[model samples]
Target: MTRYLYKELHLAASPISWWFLAGALMTLLPGYPILVGSFFICFGVFQSFQHARESNDVLYSVLLPVKKRDYVTAKYLYTVFMQMIGWVLCAVLTVLRMTALSGLMPYVGNALMNPSPLYLGFVLLIFTAFNVLFLGGFFRTAYKFGLPFLRFGIAALLLISIAEVLHHLPGLGFLNTTTGERLGLQFAILGGCALIYALCTLLSLRASQKRFEMLDL
Candidate 1:
C-alpha cells in the first residue's frame, strides 16, 4: 500500500509541491521552527487531496485489488512520513540559515536552535494533530471543499490558540534552555509528544477505515 500510495498520491503531487516551495520564505523569515516544519507538511497534505480529487482517485483506487483498510493505512503512513521529512528538512534549513548569517541572525538562531524538546515537541504535536484532523475529514469525504475547508479552519484556530497560550506561559523558560540544562523536562516533553502522535495516528487510521468503507465508490 505504501508503494501504491506513492504512485497514486505523492507522485501526482510532485508538481504542486513547487508552488509550496515557492513560498518557503513565509516559513523561514519568521524564525519559527514549527512554521518551517509546517511548510512542507501543509503543501503535501493539501496537494494529496487536490490531486486525489482532480484524478477521481476513489474510483481508481476501488478498481485496484487493495483492501480499504490497507488503503487507509497507506495514506496515513504516507502523511506521517511526509511530516517527519518536513520536520527534518526544516531543521536542516534552519541550521544552514543560521550558519550562513551567523552574525546577522545570531539571536534568531540561538532561540530556535536551543534544542529543547518543548519547541521540537510542539512542532511534532501540531503536525500530528493536523494530520489526525485532516485525514479524518479527507478520507471520509475525499476533497469535498466545504468539509475540508471547515475542518481546516477549525484545526487552524485551535492550534494557533494553543500556541498563543503556550507562548505566554512561564513554563516556556524551560524550553529556552539547552537540552543539557534540563534533561528531565526535555525527556518528558518528547515522550509526551511521541505518545500523543501515536494515539492520534491510530485514531485517524481507524476513522478513515470506517469512513471509507461506508462510501459508495
Candidate 2:
C-alpha cells in the first residue's frame, strides 16, 4: 500500500464505484443470475477508470512526484481492493445460503447458478477477465478505454451464462449443491481459480506498467 495508492483510492475513486459495490448484495437474490453481481463490481471499477479519463487523472498523476509504474500500481491495487471487498460479500452470503438458508425454497429452487464455492470461482474468473482484457487493454493506450470495457462486458456476460448452465450438464450438478457432498471438489475449483486470478492479475499489472512506460505522456 504505497502512499500514492492510498491517496488515489481514498481521494480519486469515483462515488459511483462505491455505490456499485453494493451489487455484491445481489447474492441474496434467487431466480436470477447472481453472478451478475461480480459483473457489477467490475463495472464499478470501470466507472473509476472512466472517471479518471474524464478528469485527466492519469496526466495529473504523472505530473506528481510519482513514477509511471507507481500510478499503474495504484490503479491495480485499488482494483484488487474493490474486487476483494466484493468477494468477501459474496463469500459471506454463500455461507448463509449453505447453512441457515439452505432449505429456503427460493434458493433451493433457483434454476440459475446457486451460491457455492463454484460460484465464487466463477466470480474470480470474471475478475480475471476484467484485469487481463479491460485493465491490460486500457494501459495499451491509456487514453482509450471504451473498447476495452466493451470487451470485458462481453466476456463477463458469457462467463455468467456458462456458470449458470454448468450445473445442468450431466454429472456436474453437484456444482450447485448446497450440501457438503462434493465439498472437496468445490474447494478445489475455488482454489484453482484463486491461483489463476492471482497469477493473471500480477501478469496484467506488469504488462500494464510496461505499456504505460512506453507511452509518450
Candidate 3:
C-alpha cells in the first residue's frame, strides 16, 4: 500500500496538481474568499484523476499483484496527503494573520472571512464534500469523471459562498475575527469539522473499494 501510494505521488499524479497547492497563499488576501483555496486544491486532485482515466491508470493498476482494495486506499491516501499539505499552509498563514499581521490595516478592517479557525473548519468541510461526492462518484464507473467533478465543483462553490457570508449574519460575526475572538468556540467548530472530514472520507473509501472490486476491468 505504501509503495502504491508512493507511485501515486511520483507517477500517477498530474504535474500541475502540485502547483495548485499554491492556492493556499490566498489566505493572505484581505476581503477575498480565501476558502477558494480549498476548491482549487480539490480541482488539482480532480486533474490527477482525469489523467489517470485518460492513461488507463486503473486498468494498469489492477494488473499489478495487489489487492483491489489497495488501489482505493492509495488514491484516498494521496488525496488526503494533498489536502493536509494545503491545510498546513492555511494554518501557518492563519497564525501569521492572528499574530504578527493581525494589526495591519487591511486585514484588521477586512469585512470578509479572515484566516481563522472557522475558516479552516470551512476548508475541511469543502474537502469533505469533494471526497464524498467526487471521489466516491468516480469509482461507480471508474471511467466517467466529468459529471462527478462537476457536482463537486458546484458543492465546493456553495460551501465557499456560505463560509464567506456566515460571519455577516446576525450574532455569528466572530467567525471573521483576526484576533481569534471566541477562541474556544472556533476550536470546537474546527474539531467538529475535522471529525466530519475523517468519517466521511473513510466511508467514501470503503464505498469506492467495493465499487472497484465489482468492476469488470
Candidate 4:
C-alpha cells in the first residue's frame, strides 16, 4: 500500500505534473489566498488520472499483484499528499502575508490569509465535495465526466472564497481586538476543522472503495 502510494505521489509530482503543481503558486497572491493552490492540487489529480487512463497506466498497473482497492487507496493517498504540499505553501504564504501585509488587515481577516485549524476544516470540506464529484464520476464513466465535475468544483470554490472575503471583511475589526478573544476563536475553529477532517477522510476512503469496485479499471 505504501509503495503504491509513493509511486502515485512520485508520478503526480513529476515533469509536467510538477509544473502544474508549481502553477498553484500563482493563486497565493492577495485576495485569492488558497483558492488557486487548492484548485491546482485537485487539478493535478485529474491530470494524473487522465494520463493513467490514456496511457493505459491503470491497465498496466493493475497487471501487478496489487488489488484494485490498493490502486484506489493510492489515488486517495496521492490526493492527500498533494494537499499537504498545498497546505505547506499556504502556510508560507500566510507568514509572508502577516509580516508584509499586516497593515492591510482592516480589509482582509487574518483567517482569510493564514493557516489555521479552522481553515483546515473548510479545506477538507471543499476537497470532500471535490472528491465526491470526481472519484464518484470517474468511477462511473472512466474519467468522462470527471473533468467537468472537477472544473465545477474549482469554479465554485473560487467564487465562494471570493464571496467569503467580501462578506466577512466588515467584521474583521477583530484583528485589532484582544489576543485572548482571537485565540479563543482560533481554538474553536481548529476543533471544528479537526472534526471535519476526520469525517471527510473516512467517508472519502470508503466512497472511493465502493466507487473503484464499480469500475472496470
Candidate 5:
C-alpha cells in the first residue's frame, strides 16, 4: 500500500506537475488571493485523472494486485499532496513578490506585509473548500460520468464561486480582518475545515471503490 501510494505521489509530482506550480506563481504574483492557487491545483489533479484514463493506465491499475479501496485512497492522497505543494509554492511566491515590490517601494511592501486576518482566513477557507469539493466531486463524477475532466472542471468552478461567496459573509467577516487578534479563530476554522475534508475524502474513496466494482471491465 505504501509503495503504491508513493508511486502515485511520484507521478503527481513529476515535471508535468510543475505546470501547476508555475501557474500558481503567475496567478498569485500580484498578491490577488490564495484561491487562485487552489484553482490551479484542483485543475492539475483533475488533469492527472483524465490523463490516466486517456492513456488506459487506469484500467491497468485495476489489474494490479492492489485492492480497489487502496487504489482509490492512493489517488485521493495524491490529489491532496499535489494541491498542498501548489499552495505552498504559491504562498512563497506571493511573499517573495511582496518583498521585492516592497524593496522597490517601501509603502507598497509595507501594505502587503500586514495581510488582513480576514484575507488569510478567506484564503485558508478557499484552500479547504477546494480540496473537499474537488476531491469528492472529481472521483465520484469520474467514476459515474466517464468524463472526469469536464465534470471536475465544472464542479471546481461552481465550488470556487461558492467559496468566494462564503468568504464574503458578514457573520464570517473575521476572515477579512488582519489583527493578530484572531489567530486562534483562524486556526480553529482551519481545523474544522480539515476535518470536513478528511471525511469527504474517505467518502469519495469508498464511492470510487463501489463504482469500480460495478464497472464492466
Candidate 6:
C-alpha cells in the first residue's frame, strides 16, 4: 500500500502539481469563505480529472503489478494527502498574516488570530466531502463512458451545483459561524460527512471494477 501511494506521490511532484499548489496558495489571500470553498472544489475536481486520465492509460500501470483496487485506493489517498497539504498551507499563511498585522494593527490581528475550532472543523469537512464526491463521481462516470473529459465536466458541474445549494441553506453555514454552540455540532457533522464519503468511495470502486472487466486492455 505504501509503495502504491509513493507512486502516486511521484506523479504529484511533476510541474503540473506546482500549478495546483500555487492555486491553493492563492486561495488563502482572499480570506473569504466562498472563495476558499471554490478553491477546494476546483482543486478536487482537477485532481479527479488527473486520476481518471492516468487510470485510462493502458501502459501506465503495466510495469506495476498492483491490483485495480489498490490503484483506485492510491488515488483516493493521494487526494486526501494533497488536501492536507493545502490546509496546512492555508493555516500557515493565515497565521503569518495575523502575526504581521499584530505589529501595526492590534484589533485586526486579534480578530484574525483567534479562529474557532468550529471554523477549522467546517473547513476540513467541506474539503474532505468535496474531494470524495468529485473524485468518486468522476471515476465512476469515466469508467463507465471511457471519456475522461466528459466525466470530469459532468461530475464537476454536479458537485459545484450541490455545493452552491448547500452554501445558501440555513443551518449549514458552519464556516461563517464561530460560536461555541456551533463548535459543539462540528463532530456530529464531521461524522456524517465521513460516512457519506465512505459510501460514495465504495460505490465508485465497484463501478470502476465493473468497467475494468469490460475493457480489452
Give a tens-digit lDDT track for model 2, residues 60-131.
Answer: 788888787888898999999999999999999999988998888887778888888999999999999999
Q: Judge candidate 5 at residue 60 and give its lDDT.
A: 64
What would the per-residue lDDT of candidate 4 be over residues 148-169, giving only the tens digit for each residue?
5656577557744753564256
Clashes of each: 0, 0, 0, 0, 6, 0
Model 6: per-residue Cα lDDT at residue 164: 39
The lDDT values for all models are: 0.61, 0.90, 0.88, 0.59, 0.55, 0.50
- Against the true structure, candidate 1 reaches a TM-score of 0.76
Off by over 4 Å in 5: 9-14, 26-28, 31-33, 90-173
1 against 4, candidate with superior TM-score: 1
Preferred candidate (lDDT higher): 2 or 4: 2
- lDDT string for model 1 (87-136, tens) is 66655654554455435653453443343345456667767766776677
| Candidate 2 minimal-lDDT segment of 10 residues | 1-10
- Clash pairs (backbone) in predicted model 4: none
Against the correct fold, how does model 2 do in TM-score? 0.96
Task: List the pairs of residues colliding in candidate 1.
Answer: none
Whose lDDT is higher: candidate 1's or candidate 6's? 1
**How much does each candidate deviate from the true structure in C-alpha RMSD?**
3.7, 1.1, 1.1, 4.1, 4.6, 5.7
Q: Return whichever of 1 and 2 wins on TM-score.
A: 2
Better of 1 and 5 by lDDT: 1
lDDT by residue (42-131, candidate 3, tens digit) is: 888888988877787887787789898788888999999999999999999989988999889988778788888888999999999999
**Model 4, position 177: C-alpha lDDT score:** 30
TM-score of each: 0.76, 0.96, 0.96, 0.74, 0.69, 0.58
Tell me the tens digit of each residue's lDDT in model 5 across 52-153. 656665666767787755666777677767766765665565455435543444334331222333333334455455444555555554444334445555
- Largest lDDT belongs to which candidate? 2
Error of 5 at 172 (Å): 5.9
In angstroms, give how far residue 113 of model 1 lies from its true place. 9.8
